[model samples]
Target: MKIKEGFVLHSVGDENVVVAIGKMTKKFRGMIRLNSTGAFIFRQLEKETDEKGIIDALIAEYGIDEQTATTAATTFVSQLKDAGVLDI
Candidate 1:
């Protein structure tokens, strides 16, 4: 349920654009591409440990209902898993 140890985040010229890096590679594989909202969720997951904490943080930060936030966070995490970016 968390990003793997060797991955890092970087910006591409503009601060708004973000990319992911995996260890042992000079060029990122570009397995996952995230928009600003997805990036926010990704950063939050980096700081938080579990699904509940992530859902709570998103709810507090975005002022959204628990169900809505949970749904979005769950979907995002699933996408990361499918992309091989997460170790959970």
Candidate 2:
């Protein structure tokens, strides 16, 4: 899954955030929110272009076991799906 276009990322304090910018005459605003972990996973998905690659990257970056990383990535993916932000 990948983040949809028209979305911009920002850092709010210690958390990484995703804000959807409205198009045309609509006012710019955030349409979805994600926590730091979710943002990290989203960023990986944006780069890797596949689930397996995302899992591998997560393991390498976080030093977590494969199972743990897979579970976390799955959950984060679900959240993005539910929010209509995923392009899978």
C-alpha lDDT values of all predictions: 0.70, 0.73
Per residue, candidate 2 scores C-alpha lDDT tens digits across 8-82 of 677877767777665611543554566767777877766537777778888898899999988988877888777
User: What is the lDDT for 1 in model 2?
Assistant: 57
TM for every model, in the order presented, reads: 0.75, 0.80
**Model 2 stretches with alpha carbons more than 4 Å out:** 22-31
Which is the leading candidate under TM-score?
2
lDDT by residue (24-75, candidate 1, tens digit) is 2454454455776687778876653677877888888889999998898889
Q: Residue 42 in model 1: shift from native, Å?
A: 0.8
The candidate 2 region of ten consecutive residues with least summed lDDT is: 24-33
Error of 2 at 56 (Å): 0.4
